[model samples]
Target: MSDESNQTEGPIAGISDVPVTLTVSVGRARPTVGELLSLTADDIFTLDKSLDDPVDLYVGDHLVGRGVLEELDEPGSGRLGIRITEIAPIKDLV
Candidate 1:
């Protein structure tokens, strides 16, 4: 009954394979540095959120969940996925 009592009864048992970086905040645009140096390559800048907005899932700035932006046709893996919906309360993700 020891290994330090099973690692103190698992308070995230030894970092739980530590690795954290989940940030998918899909909207934010404050273009001005002369509209970000007058970009020209199919230029389009307008985002404060629109397109059925609900995408914000961070692990650093801590907003921890909310999603709905998905497009993964799966033929050639045209990636982009997130469909969580809402989940920010484990004491607001610490």
Candidate 2:
């Protein structure tokens, strides 16, 4: 690595105190409160969305990004591909 590469010509921006959230969906077939309480390790619930559909992601209730799933860490672990995504600064909402 070069020392000069670490230096920048402009003032640093966005030293933010912003908070964000991340959530993943396995197709949103979530159960109702009564049904949820009855669920156990052996139980099965089906998803409302199709497997090939684009997954929706949100920060709070706002849409933030979109992606298809790709495995990470191991076979059961995956990351979103995050296509066409943007996070509008929180101050804009205020």
Model number with the top TM-score: 2
The residue-by-residue lDDT of candidate 2 on 1-94, one tens digit each, is 2366554343332323345776655477768999998878989888887776667667677665566655555675554454434455545433
As a TM-score, model 2 comes out at: 0.52
What local lDDT does model 1 show for residue 18? 64
Local lDDT at 93 for model 1:
55
Clashes of each: 0, 0
lDDT of each: 0.79, 0.60
**TM-scores for candidates 1 onward, in order:** 0.29, 0.52
RMSD of each: 12.6, 5.8
lDDT of 1 by residue, 1-94 (tens): 3456445233455664568999888799988898778798999988999988998999899898898988788656778789898888665554
TM-score of 1: 0.29
lDDT of 2 at 74: 62
